[model samples]
Target: MVRPDGSIRVGTATVAGVLAGTVLAGCGTVGGSPAGKETSSTREQDTKAVRSAYGKTAEQDTARVTLRVQTSADGTSMTASGRGTVDLRDGDSVMTLSAQGGRVEQRVVDQVLYQKLPRSEVPGGKPWIRIDLQKAAERRAVGGQSVNDPVQAAAFARAIDGKDVTREGTSEVGEVNTTHYRVAVDVAELPDGATLRRQLGPTLPMDVWLDGDGRIRRQQIDMTLKAPAEDAATDRASSPPRPAKVRTVMEFSDFGTDVEAKAPPPRQVTDLTGTALERGQTQN
Candidate 1:
């Protein structure tokens, strides 16, 4: 099947739209001052200029995001890559995640998400699964699970809110020369669903890039995990805590443009509410 974005669906899953791997949940204000040399804009003023650009980008009608993510810790490593679009006005989105041999895609509308899992993850041979975000939030999947949704898109810039930010000069993103900013995010300040307690614990490192129009151009988020200290009662504090790093990169383009995404065919879609909802809860 050909999706509105002009991508063909493979297998039973309907194909559409497409990520760095991280769906935005919480974004904030910035900290610090401009780096490099003195210029026409004061360091503090440059920081605000950078923040202003992101502020405007967040208010656009849509964002086309390409993403790559790599996570490593505890001697294991995992990598995920995808592409997707977010409707800034409504939090609706479509994404195609990586799967063996083919791609598993999903669409979000009216707080309901319709998705096609990898064939290996399909239940009872069903090609598509529908999930209600309102319900999913009840099950502890609140933060990042809703990244594809617009609510997070609106809130993403909040990551730099009230924090010190510094200009890192200019860098090219998606071939566009962008002004770069370095930001530090306290775990407590992150948006509700984008908290790093489970990933980074204390703080998360982040980067933001903006183009001339003050729109977001790219982002980099660094998260690290540490293995828990062994139980003193059970045995010696051996193994201490092994640290792992996760890198997430997101590039944005096509701001304010309409995304070509539509609902999958009805026959191919299944609801995740009721008993089906219980059987397929996306979280615990």
Candidate 2:
């Protein structure tokens, strides 16, 4: 079995390369309105329409959604793809994701369990590991349930209450026509630890686009962070070193809403170290 670090190296390269190629080939230049052009009334109508379409009482039946996720870690320069499914009703939802590459596969059931180990590491050579997704989901969902930013949520709600909405414009995303909206919020009002703080400056700049029914089609956000100056002195003193920048992208479709997804039976997690131990005992 490959060493954990070695496996990570191989998997990262494969996933990152695939993501780069796809993004370049499929995501052509996005052309649309620049900032400061959209009218307030237009934005309001778009937000209202989306909220009305998705907002439901807690007792409402759940709607199933399958989304593709592509992630690139900045330090590792590796990209990976995963499939996520959400069953949402009212404000509650269940999310699951599965990602695989090389001799490794990982599954997160209901955003709770997170298990990853080598495929060849299992006792019987099973190529996957089981994790507890329920615990993981709860830890990550402490803030709220919606996928969008909390600030945006509050801004949207206030806009609806104040009868003000800003329509940014229209753009095409993969042949789908999407309407854009710019919901206003003060920079100081943003929640701490928001993605904006991680990506750009303290202020959060965002653009949200929705389909005709108010389903979020896409979102762009900008923020910043501080790091040691990249001078020679800083480099020599850096202990862990920085990771590479790689991005992954994934897409999912045709989720069978009627056919519910069932979790696999309980099993032990597997890894390269475990496989070595099992093989040694077998030799006796």
Candidate 3:
């Protein structure tokens, strides 16, 4: 796939849509009361209650989440599928990212320590690059953080705290009862240069749906991004441009318990200089 600036351009596929949905959930509002002391107090209590419920629910069940990402604009599209396993008690987790066509990236994490094994080209295929887990863990402490659905879920919870939140009623999502909450969040509240707001603009609205336990089960969001002007010289050098509007929707399901995930055996690393490896040179 096309690596833009050394980072994979998560294509405009279903998975990209989901990521966009997660990010958009951190912005704006939907017909909610104006922000005031009463509104703030109620929202604080509600958010605390929600977080408490989430903690309890998480303690009771294990989450095996699958993320589908699709990113598209202009005409190009890219899709990715990933799975995440989180053990809330110890904050240990494992996440694997793979292109449906074959490429696979795996990460094994235990709290502050993590290991990014390698980017395997295909199932049982050659390794293109290997990342030391110890090094990855250190880097994460310095600033690098993996982007996953569970992380996004946590961020959403944080965003709702002490903000202007309003209940939008109940709805059924995949046979589960969900209560919808709308909150207006300012992008400024997030760290500067957050990719979501920088690429998608700063002032959009999000609608979030929570199950009875207050866990976010679904979300709908709208975002407006500034893109290059048609008359710009280069695609990357465009001036303050027209805004592109996007809508995203996401749903989470199949909550279970005591899930155990295992990392695949390590693969032999290879150089990309066109040399074919001898048969017995493979590593387990």
Candidate 4:
């Protein structure tokens, strides 16, 4: 199945719109300075600051992360939250989340995602389901998008345009004093920007908080899903409704922390890649 963002769904129990590879509860509004116009030079400076911050964050190689995802659709809304550690260089991560009155666990290593689900779902009562995102990507799954781990999700800041960045003054994330900025993500500049633009629209607004060291302390993206064109002009009763509105917030701390994400024991894992791919083909 396709996620709201068009990426292939990996497991049955997803928290909010994430968790297929990356994921949330405890999501709430964050207060910050109101957006203010900036001079051209200031805009350039802001862009440089964000880019440089991204570089510094990458250099740290590992960090502790807290995630909150809020979604609303068809008059229903839900929130999910989680915490985890990520190894930026190796693309490995381990996370545990609270959602739908249950606990969900996920691990990502070397492009493979392992999800630990309830005991009943597995054929042999295996606890973990394995999905190869690389295989899914190679298959050109219908919604066509890349799944990013928490660390890589921050890369979205790299797509910012100088003209769309506004310095929002200061705020504190956790105990760290930070500079808050409102940014417009130039979706076209991302690797999958073309597909995202077709699905999510031209530009996405974002709020980013950076510490004195220029590392991102907090970032949030509130996304509104566009209705399908074919369904747009049809009667609401006849056409399907649009997907949920998803808001994802990520907070980072403990940079340079050690993160070790190893694969689940083979006996406990059920390789679901082939079955998932077949099911996807049938749906498509």
Candidate 5:
């Protein structure tokens, strides 16, 4: 699927022209604040607890993800969705993404991402394309961010705690009662890769729900930004391009669940070797 940033990665290569587009830190230390404190009594304490809790993801690895995005550029708007399960610990995920008039299956296993294309350009109608993320990362490929390293749960605390935080109230997400907080996600404040910030551009609004365990139950981000690239659909004309507004909600469930990914059957797979791998990579 097109990443929210309006790019797609088939392996290490960017399929920007392929999809209409494409498609967090923990708490801990905050602004010269003490390095490691996990408390939740006061608002500051609560933020620290959250930042810490977010840091503790090793015990919770697998989760189901439902993602939706609407991108407008080039006088056209594209809506896409991905419903899948991911192994956060290993960064392995299998998903079916719907867009561009059809559906394609994508699986990331062992730092290798494989896609079964909607139309096979390979000989014998091979349906799969492979990209090695390890190799791609050195080149800064589209999916380079797929590194599945364990992140400090509360790492975001350093970025968000100092901002004005408002705990709106308590809400029930599923069976869990959660404390809801609304804050602006400042990209400049973040130390890690600003993936969302880069996608939404500038600062964006964020709403988060944290369970008693200080684990994130849900998060929502909404923002509008000039499209990340020249509108893929735009012709030669250069009238003011359309701005794309995106809203994303992530609800995590079944934490620590079992998640396993495997390659497509060999018969159904196609290795995008040599020139085929060099072709179709669109740079925006």
Candidate 6:
């Protein structure tokens, strides 16, 4: 679909756009101190434990994910859902997203994104559009935020272990027992956090649930955003922002699951790398 810049970005960039848009939906408020006070040493221990668990989870290499995103802007609201599996190491992934009564499937392999669209919407009647993320990067057409990297998305929980991470006790998520935590995600550490921080703020509140093994079971972010201006080519300075609110939740399962991704048959593909770059479209 077309971005605010009037350019198309399919696959991970599209998902990233929606997700990044979700997180950037609004500025964050100062977090209230957690209910229980902790000694500095205890906080350090908890943070270390959480970070270690995230590291262990990342080493698992793959997982299945289900997500929901809801956004409200200009007095209008919408919701979208997605299901996918991703290779945490290679960044290969396959995902399907549903929104407004439509579904779209996407696959990423060898740093290329393949999107399946209605035949009428694609050139040459090809049902799939191929965009080379590597080519896009080479042309500086992507913001290098790792937003399109499934690996990055999977490791997003790592942002929760900042100094302020608070253990909120234990709870059940699905059939698993998990420890609940709350923190202001450290945007500075995220690959694209600097940009997000500039657009939204330095931190965003997040709630996470971790299984005993330290793997994330569920995570949520609720934010209010100053929506970027609609002019496709205008910079933030030239366009007034819109007020909006967004919330996103994601759950993980089947860690280390096998995730397969293959490039679409060339005959059914329309390469859009050149056109996307020519339009000066950049994804964050």
Give one digit per residue, the lDDT tens place, for model 1 in 1-284: 21122111110011111222354433333333334454545555655665566447657877776655566766786655557776655556676665324565766666566677776766567788765555644453332332222234334445444445666667667667677777665555544534346545755667777788777677666766544333322334454455767566666787876666677777876665454335334322
lDDT of 4: 0.63
lDDT of 5 by residue, 1-284 (tens): 44322323211111211221122222221222232342345557655555665555435777665444455655677776555666655567666677666676777777666776666334467777666644544343342132112232333455566344556667776566777776665655553346545655555566667788777666555557554454534733756566665554445567776656798777876554332334324432
lDDT of each: 0.54, 0.34, 0.42, 0.63, 0.51, 0.61
TM-score of candidate 2 to 2 decimals? 0.49
Worst 10 residues of 2 by lDDT: 8-17
lDDT of 1: 0.54
Instruction: Show model 4 residue runs off by greater than 4 Å.
Output: 1-17, 20-37, 140-158, 229-240, 279-284
Task: Please give me the total number of clashing residue pairs in predicted model 6.
Answer: 4
Q: Give residue 19's error in model 3 in angstroms.
A: 7.3
Provide the lDDT at 175 for model 3.
64
Query: Best candidate per lDDT, number?
Result: 4
Give the distance in Å from residue 244's predicted Cα in candidate 4 to where it truly belongs. 2.2
Predictions: Cα RMSD each = 7.6, 9.8, 9.3, 4.9, 8.0, 5.9
Q: lDDT per residue, candidate 2, 102-146, as tens digits?
A: 323333234322234444445455444432222212333221112
Provide the TM-score for each candidate, comma-separated.
0.69, 0.49, 0.54, 0.80, 0.66, 0.75
> How far does residue 193 in candidate 1 sit from its true spot (Å)?
8.6
Cα-based RMSD of candidate 2: 9.8
Off by over 4 Å in 1: 1-41, 99-102, 142-163, 193-199, 226-244, 265-267, 272-284
Model 6: how large is the Cα RMSD against the reference? 5.9
lDDT tens readout by residue for model 6, 1-284? 32211111222323334322243222232343356667788778667666665456667887887666677876688876667886655556777766667666777687776777754467778888777766665554543224323345434556655576787777677677777777776767666566666655777777767788877777666666544445434646664546666666666688878787888899999888787677545333
Q: What stretches of model 3 exceed 4 Å from their correct place?
A: 1-61, 78-85, 88-107, 111-149, 152-158, 161-163, 191-197, 203-205, 219-233, 236-256, 267-284
* Ranked candidates, highest lDDT first: 4, 6, 1, 5, 3, 2
